[model samples]
Structure formats: structure tokens, C-alpha cells
Target: MKQHIRLLKTYLKPQRKRVVLLVLLLFGSIALDLLAPRQLSLFIDGAEAGASLDALVTVAVVFIVLTIAKQLVVAVAGYFSEDVGWRATNALRADLADHCLNLDISFHKDHTPGELMERVDGDVGVLSDFMSLFVFSVLGRALLAVGILGLVFSTDYRIGLLLLAYSLFVVLVLRRLQSVGVPHFNALRRTKADLSGFLEERLTSTEDIRANGARPYVMHRLSEHVENLVRRTRASMISARVFSSVLEISLAAATGGVFALGAWLLPGGSISLGEIFLIYYYTQLLSLSLIVITHHLDTLQKATGAIQRISELYHTTPQVRDGEGGSLPDGALDVTFDAVSFGYGEASRTLDEVSFALPAGETVGLLGRTGSGKTTLTRLLCRAYDVDAGAVRLADVDVRDLRLADLRDRIGVVTQDVQLFHASLRDNVTLFDATIDDGHIERAFAELGLSDWYASQPDGLDTVMVNGGETLSAGEAQLLALTRVMLRDPDIIVLDEASSRLDPGTERLIARATERLLKGRTGIVVAHRLATVRKVDHIVVLDDGEVCEAGPRERLEADPASRFSALIAGGTA
Candidate 1:
């Protein structure tokens, strides 16, 4: 409920003027409708009193004028309501999209893309219906109901009492129905999210399913999700239909009772024929008003479910954020890990009191087995997650004290898993930066020995790479990833060197490009091949996050007692 109100406040504050105008238009339209029946009553009485044809003509003309005025007001109200509703929803969706992009990486780890998309898309759709119809309908019906009751009372107190009692009963029924609807709709919405997440996971892993011939298994799981979704939807629809039925029946009962009572009172001269006729019209108007109220109630119930879903996302705070009054150094680079110990929650430490330092402009090689904390160390350098304990510093300034952007701007990372978007090659290389010209892109590609590959493509730099397309081979893809990082040209580079088996020719090419890219720049290479270590200035051997040995590569390789020498002798390098 709090979340729903928060979302409403965001849109309502911006659209208060439109809301007010819509209210005025609805009141005017309903007033004209209620008054039109009264005018007809006067016409009927004039006819019974032997009035001339001119009197009937004047009454007819007034009725036509009132109807036309009401229609014009209604049309304008509908147009403005829709205009404000869509505009407000668009603004909200934009804010949600922006928030998703800036959220912490761990947030993505916990949520699927489809779930987020549904919150932004489906949830906003729910809000749109309420803003466009339910909100305006509620205001219009309230004014119409109150005015009609007051008008009825002016004519006959007994009739007014009867109508008011019936209206309260109908209202109570609708309110109870809504109370039941809220929870059911909320259940339906959760099922929708589940279906979305399930479908997304399957689509992303379609190739694996096909390769493994697990079609039957996947189909069965999808069928289960679909069945659950259908059940929830059916239940919600049944509830709505039942509520509408009750409202319709109650309206019929009230209309009949009003006629019976009016007939009895007319014999006592408590009401005239024209008054009885107008009372019937009032009862019909009340019925139509109740129907509209029921319809809007269903819409409001659906929106409440949606609002609850979206609010959950907006309320979540990211685990990672910028530091207080922090700034980056304006120098080459000096990275140090002072007794750093880190882990994922409650798990064994991935990095345990690991300490090391690299002077500015020096290249170091990090050798470790899988899960030995090589990538974890690079993640720390980028401040992807805060350290569990100890400190990582650059140029004697604690990383925690540096502004997030400034800290990340000084470092570049190229992981083994390279993800490319379905966009033009130029966009991928420059990361959509308008300031990076073709010449700069060309230089980055040329430096990485990818100029020929780019030139061979039919569209050159403008060619689109499909998502997950093997447009570039393993080595070529690694080279392009290098080009991406080189475009940033940060002071520190962390390379999770590719483990793909490269031919002699491709190996030599990568070695040369790697040397050139690391020249006079501080670098840490998560080395996969033994030859990669020989070229580095220093070597750090890690075993389960703890540093086993650290020294110049030649010195470590020469020491028989060293972990590096033992691994070399064991032919595990």
C-alpha cells in the first residue's frame, strides 16, 4: 500500500492541473445529465396543463443544447485524461530504465532481465489504466451520485431516503468485492513475473537445450509455468465477473422497489405523474453510475497489483555506491593490497590477507588456477564490490576514498568472456561515445592487428554484429576486446588472458600486440600460458587467494624451492 501511494504521488504531483480540469468537466457533464431529466419533467407537466406547442418546442431545444454541451465536455475530458496518463507513464518508465542501468552489478546477479523489463513494461501498463479511466471515473461518479441524491431529496424526502439506502448497499458490495480482488490480482501478477523469468532463461539457453536434445524436459517445465499462470488469471477473472453480476442484480432490485414506492405515494398526492417519471429516470441513472463504478474498481485493483511490483524495485538500494568526498590520483599508477581479505557472504575467503604492490608503469603477471582469485583481484581494482577487510590503494590513496567514476576511469579490464551487443562495429569499439572519431578507432584496431579483419568486412566499421554471433574467431574476438579497453586508454590494465588454444601464428601476433599495449603502462595479467609470464617484469603466484611466491619472473623460475619452480617441474604451467 505504501509503494502504491508513493508511485501515485510521483505522477499525481505533476498532473494536478489536468486532474482538476477533468474533475470540472465530469461534474459539468453529470450536472447537465441530471438537470436534463428535470427539464423533461417540466415539459410533461406543461403538456398536462394544456400548454401550447411552442412550450414543447422550447423544452426540446433546451434538452438538445444541454446534451451537445455535455458531449463536448466529455470528449475534452477523455482526450486530456489519456494525454496526461500516457505522458506520466512514459516519464516513469524512463526513470526506471535509468535506475536499472545505474544499479549495482550484484543486483543483476540476483534479478533476470525479463523480470526487470516486466516491472518497467507490465507494471507501468497497470498504472496507465488507472490514470486513464479509473481515476477519472471515480471523480465523475462521486459528483453524479451526490448531486442526484440531493436533487431527489428536494423533490421528496422518502424517495431520497430509499435511493441513498440502496446506493450504500451497492457500495458495500463493490467494496467487499474489491477487497477480495486485490489479493487475487496480486497473485496473478506474481505468476506473470515467474512466467517471464522462466521464458527468458529458456530463450537465453536455447542453444544448450538443443545441443543436449533436452527439448522434452524444457517443454515440460514451460508447460508447468504456463498452467500456473492460466490458473491465476482464470481465478481473477471469475472474481470480477461474480462482483459485476452482484452489482447488476442489486441495481435491478432497487429500480423495481423505487417504482413500487412511487406508485403508492402518488395516490396520496405526495408525488405527481411527472415526479414519478423523473424518479424512474433517477433510478436508471443510479444504476448506470454503479456499473461504471464497478468497472473502475476492477481497473484500480489491477493497478494496485502492478504498483506493488514496481515499488519493490524502486525501493531496493544498491550495495555498491560512491565514496564520500573521494577523488582519483592524477599520476601513472601505483596499486597496493595491504593485508586484504575478501569473500562472498559467509563463504570461505576468495582472497585471504593477500598483500602485494606494483610501482608505476610496471607490468606484473598473476598465475593461478581456476577460482584462485585472479579475476576477484581485478574486480577489486575496479571497485565492483567493496573489500570485506583491509584496503586496496592507488598512489597511496585508499580506493574506498576515491570517487567511483574516477577510480574506474583509471583502470581497464578485458575478461575472457567477451560480451558484444547487436550494434554497429563502431558503436561497440567506441562504446557509443560521439567524441571517439574514426581515426581514433582505426588507431586502436591497428594497434591490436585487427585492421585487416575490419577491412575485410563488407560494411567495414558500419557492419552490425548480431548478439552472440561468432563474427570474429576466438583470437580475433579477444583482440577486439583489447581494442575496446585500449580506446579508454586507462593508466592501469587488467587482462584475464584468453585460455583458447591459439595456433603458432596467432600466438605470435597476440604476444606482440600484448607487449605494445602494456608498454609504459601498469598492468596485471592473469596468465594462462607459461610463455606469457616470461615477458612480464614480476610474477605473483597465488594458491587459493594466498600469495605463495612473489618476485621477478626469472628469479622465481630459477629458485627450486619456489612454488613457480615446482609447478614448472610438475608440467602444470
Candidate 2:
């Protein structure tokens, strides 16, 4: 409940004027609805008294005008309500997206992209009813109920007091049932998210699944998820049915009691015929008002479940927080790893007490077999994960003391697999940044010897890469990736097997581009090919998570007993 109230204030506070207008219009419409009952009672009394036809016509026409005005006000109020809901939820979606982006990479590892999408988009969609209906329509119904009782009191206080107690009883009962199905709905939502994640994972891996003859296995797993979804959905539906049945019983009993009392009072001239009719009519109106609330109550349970999930997401603070330190020094920056130790979750250490350094304007080649912490080293340098022990420093200043944005801005990373978005080549190169001019991109392609490749495109940078650049070959993607890094002109460059994807034909082109890229920057090359690391100033060899050897590349190559020399002789590096 507190979370619900907090969300309401956070979103509704921005649209103050629309909210006020909606409230006035809604209450005005309710006033007209309530007055119609009174007008009906007046008509009944006038007919009983044989009042003139002209007088009756005037009252009838007034009632028709009231009805029409009420509809117009309601239609306008609905527009405001929907507009407010869409605006609030869209803002919330943007906030959620930004928040998720800032969270630790580990958080993303636990949740699939599809699940996150559902949380940010689908769960918030459920709250549209809560935001639009709960904000004003719920209150309008309550006001309508009160007005019904007020008119009844003017007719007769006895019925007024009885109906008030009934209203309270219905409210209490319904409120209790509202929470009864929320737990089921929450579980149902989780099953839905899991289903989405499963589908997305399978769809993305379609080629691998088909090539390996694992389509049958995939379908079996999908079936299991679908079965789980059905079970949870069934449970939620049963709970809702129970809630609706109870509401129906309460309404039926209340209506019967009102009619019975009105009949008893009509005898012995205690209340006039028109008075009985007015009481009955208001009682029916009150029942209809409660029916509206009952409908909202059902949606409220679903929205409550959604709110619980969204609140949890908002409250989740990231482990990696921005530092309060000053900006890093300009120009090429030396990189340092001092007795660093780290692991993912409860797993054994990935980089254990490993240490190395690259002087400014120099390059170090990292030679390591598989699972030797080569990638983890680069990750630590980029501050993707903090060290469990010791520190990663730039220019001898601990990275933990630097702002994350500034730290990352000065370091560039190029990986074997490049992720391209479905956008124009220019947008992909500049990452949708309009600040970078076309000349800079063209220059980058030239520096990397990709000018011919760029020109081959039908429309140059304006050419849209279809489906995440699938049209580009593996070698072409690497060329584009190198050009992207060169454009950034970072102080430090980490190439994690960046050339592993290039064909033999593009090897020299990539090598020349890499040499140019590392000219004045501190560079760390995680290499599997000796030719890739042969030109580096220094070499660091790793076995397991520890650094086994470190020295000047020429000296290490000269020493046959060195680990770097042994790896080269064995054709491992």
C-alpha cells in the first residue's frame, strides 16, 4: 500500500492541472447522475398529483439535458485520465531503462533481456488501469455512493443509516478480498516473464539449435514453461472467480434488504409512494456505484502485484556506484594492476592476486591459455567489476577513486564479436551521437584502410545495416569495430582478440590499423597469436588466474626458459 501511494505521488504530481480538471469534471458528472434520481422522484410525485402536462414536460426536458451534459463531461474526463496514465507510465519506462543500464553487469547476467523488457514494459502496462482509474474514477464512484445515501437521508433517515452501514460492510469485505488473489497474480507474472525469456533465448539461438539437432529439446523445454504458465494462470483465475462470486452475493443481499425495508415503510402511510420509489431508485444507483468499484477492485489486485515488482526494481541499488573523486589526467595514461583478486558470485577466483603495468604510450601483450583470466584483466581495467582485493590504478591513482564515467571514457575496448544495432552505418559508427561529424568517421575508415569497404556501400554511411549488420561478414565487422575505436581516440586501448575474426586477406590491414591505434596510447593486447603480440613492448604470461611471467617482450623472447618463450615454442601463443 505504501508503495502504491508513493508511485501515485511520483507520477501524478507532474500533471497537477490535468488532475484538478479531471476531478472537477468527474465529480460534476456524478452530481448530474445523482440529481437524476431526485428528478425521477419529483416526476413520480407530480404524476400522482396529476400536475399539468407543461410542468411535467419542463422537468422531463431538464432531466434529458442533465443526462446529456453528464455524458459529455464523462467522455472528456476519460480522455484526461488516459492521457495522464500514458504520460506517467512512459516516463516510468524511461526511468526504468536508465536505472537498469546503470546496474552492475552481474545483475544483467542473472536476468535475460526479455525478462527485463517485460519488467520495464509489460508490468508497467498493468499499472495503466491503476493510474488512470484509481486516480479519479475510484474517487468518483465513492462520491456517487455518498450522494446516493445523502438523498436517501433527505427522504428518510432510517434508510440512510442502514445503507451507510451496508456500504461500509461491502467496502471492508471487498478490500479484504483484494489482497487474496494478489499473491497468485504475482506468481503468474513471474511465470509470464520466464516464458518470455525462454522464447527470446530460443529464438536468438535458432541457428545453433537447428544445426545441432536440438530443436526437439528446445520444444520440450518450451512445453514445460507453457505448462507452468497454465498452472499459475489457472490458480489466479480461480482466485478471481472467488472474489467476484463473493461480491455478487454482497450486492444481492444489500439490494434485497433495501427493497424489503422500503416495502415495510410504504405501508401505514409512514412514507409516501413517491418516497418509497425514491428510496428504491437511490438504492439501485448505490448498487451500481458499488459495482463499478468492484470492477476496479479486480484490476487493483493485478496492479498491486505489478506495483510490487516495479517497486522492487526501483529500490534495487547498483553495487558499482559513482566515485566522488576528480577527473583523470589528460593524454595517454599508464595502467596498473596491483595484487588484484576477484571472482564472480561464489565461483573460484577469475583473477587472483594478479598484477601488471603498462607505461604511458607503450603496449603490453597478454599471453594466456583459455580460462587464464586474460579477459578478466581487461574487465577489471575497465572497472566493469571491482577487485575483491587490491586495486586497478591509472597513473598510480586507484581506479576506485575515479568517477566511473571518466574512467571508462579514457579507455576503449574492442572484442572479437562486435554487436551492431539495426541502424544506418553512420549512426552505428557514432553510436547515434549527432555530435560527431561525417569527416571524422571517414578519416577513421581511411586510417584503418577501410575506405574501399566504406565506398562499396551503395549509400556510404547512409546505408542502413540490415538486422544488426548481418549483411557484413565477420572480417568486415572487425574492420568496422577497429574504426569505431580509432574514432574515440581513448588514452588506453584493450583489444581482446580483436583480430581473431579477420580473414587472412584483411590481416595486414587490421595489423596496420592496430599499430596506428596504439601509437600514443597505453595498450593491452590479449592475444592468442604470437604474430599479434610480437611487436608489443612488454609481455605478461598467465597460467590459471596468476601472472606467471612478465618482462620486456624482446628479453622474454630471447630467454628460452621464460613462460612466454615456452608458449611461443609450443605454438600456444
Candidate 3:
């Protein structure tokens, strides 16, 4: 509950004045409702005394005006509540995105993208409703009930006492029931998030599911999840609804008792006919308030569950960040790794005591087996993840000392897996940067040997690429990714077998493009193909996450003791 209050403060702090205004308006509305019964009682007494028609008309007009004002205030409060709710949701979503992007790589590895999406999107949506409805419903009704009870008690003690007793009983029972059912409803929310994540994962992989003839299997899993959600929802609804219905029935029975007692004591003049009517009206208002408040209590429960999930993402801190007062590097670039060691959680170290130095303007090849930590080393160069021990140096400064944007800007990467968003070809190449030069785009395509294919597209640069680059073949997507790096023209190049996806003819084009792209810039090529690696100025063989051999490509290939020599002989070089 404290956590929920703190979370709500973020929403309320932005609209403090509006919240105060809403409270004042609602108080006025409640005052009007309480005064309505008093005015009617006065009119009844005046009519019995044969008051003038003009006096009655005046009272009636005042009643109508007050009712209209009350309704107007309610409408305004509703509008403002919705606006505040939406703005809070926007703030929450933006903050969640920032946190998700900055979270530790280990967090991302543990949670699926779809699950995180459900937390940030689906869960936050529930909070929007809670913000808009919870306060308005609960506070407004509670105030109304208190005002009416006060008026009723002032008019007649006997009837007010009976009504108050019944109201307290109903509220206590309903609150207890709500408390018991909250945990169940919270469980229901978790199941719903799971359902959403499962559907999202399956839908995104629909092609693979169908191709492998696992449609029935997938459907069975989806059906089971849905059934579980339905069962949980049904049980929660039944318990809450049953408790609410029983409270209403008990209140009705108690109302009958109040009237009977009032009648029995009527001759003694403890209560009157008019006071009975007022009590009935007050009881109706109190019951209505209770019903609406209870409904939103359920909503509040769900929202709290959602807030818990969103808070998980909000609280996560990134493991890797810039050093104190970091800034971009300037001038000639040199990369050095000093006894750097790293590992995924609980797994064997992927890179162990690896030390290396590459002077500016040198091409280096990282030769290794499938799990030899080649890609991990490249990620460290970009500071994608910080090392577990030791330091990575760029231009004699620790990599962490450089601003993230500055570090990423100075390095260009093309990995084996190419991911393209759903956008125009030009957007993918320039990444929607407004200041990219047109000449750079043109030259990038030509340098990557993709100018002819790009020109043949329906709209050339403006042509739309479908989601995940599904419209283009795998090799074409790889070329587009390469063209993207070419346009950037960074000081350092990291190519993780970007040409492996292409055909033999396309491979030759990529090789020529690679040579042109690497000129006068430091490069790290992680490749399995012998022909592709042979072009680099130097090669370093990696085994079990350590440097095993190092020399020029030809010298390493000639040495029988070298791992690269063995890999070449095995046709996996």
C-alpha cells in the first residue's frame, strides 16, 4: 500500500491544483445533495401551513438550479480526471522506455521482450483507469455519504442512528470481503500478463510455427492459457459479486427493521413521516455510493498489481554507464584491452584475461571457434556491456570514461544478424537522422555494391521495407546493414561476418566493398571463412576465451601449432 501511494504521488504531483479544485467541487456537490432534503422538508411544512404558490415556486426553482450546478461540476471533474490520467500514463510509459533501454543486459537476457512489453504497455494501461476512476469514485462517494449522514442525524437522532448502524455494518462487511478477494484478483492480473506474452511470442513466430506443422501444439498451449485465465477470472468475480450481493440484501433487511422500529415509536414522537422519507433517500444515496466505490475498489486492486509489475522495470538500474564527468574522445583512436574478463551469469567466463592492443589505422582479424567470445569482445569495444574485471581502453582512457553516444558514434558495426525496422529504405539507411548527407547515402550503396539493387526498387531510397526486412532476402538485408555502417563513416569498424549471408558472386562484391571500407581505419573482422580473413593485416587466434596465437594471417596459417592452421585444415577457417 505504501508503494502504491508513492507511485500515485508521481501521478498526482503534476496536477496538485486540479486535484484540490476537484475536491472543492465535489464538496459543493455533496452540500447541494444534503440541502435538497432539507429544502423539501421545508416545502412540505410550508404547504401544510397553506404557504403561497409563489413561495413554493421559488423553492422549486432553487432546487433545480442547485441540481444543475452539481451535475455541471461532476462533468467538469470527470473531464479533468481523464486528462490527468492520460498525461500520467504518458509519463509512466516514457519513463518505462527510458528504464528498459538503460537496464542491465542481464535483465534483458532473463526476461523476454514480449513479457517486458506487456509490463510496460498492458500493465500501465490498467493504471490509467485507476488514476481516472479510483480517486473520483471513492472520495466523492465517501464524502457524499458523510454529508448526508450528518444532515440526517441533525434532523432526527433515532432514524439517523438506525441508518448509521446499518451503513457501518455494510461497509465493514464489504471492506473485509474486498480485502480477502484482492489477492485473488492480483493473481488474475499476473495470468493475464502471461497470456498476453504467450500470444505475442506465438504470433511473432507464426511463420515458423506453421512451417514446422506445430499449429495444433501451439493452439493447445494457447487454449490452456486462456482457460486458466477464464477460470481464475470466474472465481474472483464470483467471490466479489457474491459478497456484494449479500451485503446489499442484508442492508435491505436492516432497512425493514429500521422502519418497523420507527413506526413502533412513532406515537411517542421520536421520529416523523417526513424524517422517514429523508432517511429512505439518504439510505439510497449511501447504498449507491457504496456500490460504485466497491466496484472501483476492485479496479484499484488490479491497478496496484499493474503498478507492481511496472515498478520492477522502473527500479531496474543499468550495469554499464559512463565514468565521472565523461566526454567524447578526440584525435587518433587506439583500442586496448587490459586483462579484461567477462561472463554471462553463472556461466564459465566467456573472455578470460584477454589483453590486446591495436594502433590507429590497422586491420585486425579475431579468429575463433563458435563460442570463443569473439562477439563478446566486440561488444565490449562499443561498451555494450562492461567487463567483469579489468578495463577496456580507447585512446588511453578507460572506455567507461567516454560518453555512450560519443563512443557509439565513433564505432560502426555490421553483425551476422541484420534487423531492419518497418520503414522506408532511406529511413533504414540514415536511421531517420535529419542531417545525413544525400551524397553519403549514394556513396554508401555504391561502396557496399548495393547501388544497382537499390536503384531497381519501386521507389529507390523511399521504398518501404516490411517488418524485420521480411520483404527482402537475408543477403539483401545484410547489404542494407553494411550500407548503413558505410554511411556513418566511423573511425573504427567491427564486421562480424557481415558477408556470410550473401551468395558467392555477392560475397566477392562484399569482399571488394570491405577492402574499400577498411582503408585508413582500424578494423576488427570476426570471420570463419579463410578467404575473407586472409585480407586482414593481422590475425589473433582465440581458444576458450584467450589469445592462443597471434601474427600476420599468412604466418599464422603456416604455423602447424596454431589453432588457425588447424581450423584451415578442417575447412572451418
lDDT to native, each model: 0.82, 0.85, 0.79
List model 3 lDDT by residue over 75-157, tens digit each.
88788878778888889888887889777667778777777887888788888888888555877788888787787788677
Candidate 3 wrong stretches, greater than 4 Å:
261-266, 434-440, 443-449, 468-470, 487-489, 558-561
Worst 10-residue lDDT window, candidate 1 = 323-332
Question: What shift in Å separates residue 66 of candidate 3 from its native position after superposition?
Answer: 1.3
Candidate that beats the other on TM-score, 1 or 2, i.e. the better one:
2
Model 3 reaches what TM-score against the true structure? 0.91
In order, what is each prediction's RMSD in angstroms?
Answer: 2.8, 2.0, 2.7
Clashing pairs for predicted structure model 3, backbone only: 528-573
Question: What does candidate 1's lDDT look like per residue over 1-573, in tens digits?
Answer: 767687778877798898788778777788898988887888888888888999888997898888888888889989988988888888888888888877877788788887888888988988887878854487677678888889889889988998899889877887788889989999988788878988899888999999999889989998998899899999999999999899888888888888988989989989888888898898888788878877777677888777777788877776777777465556569989898888876768899999999988898889889788887888888888878988999988898887787888888887667777788888877778989998999988788776776788789789886666777666666666788888998889888765346677766777777777788789898876777666888888888999988888888889999888887788665
The regions of model 2 sitting more than 4 angstroms off are 468-470
The most accurate candidate by TM-score is 2
Q: State how far residue 373 of model 1 sits from its true place (Å).
A: 2.2
- Please give the lDDT score at residue 466 for candidate 3: 79
The sequence of per-residue lDDT tens digits that candidate 2 reaches over residues 28-104 is 88888888766777788899899999988888888888889988988899899899888988888889899999888
Could you tell me every candidate's TM-score relative to the true structure? 0.90, 0.95, 0.91
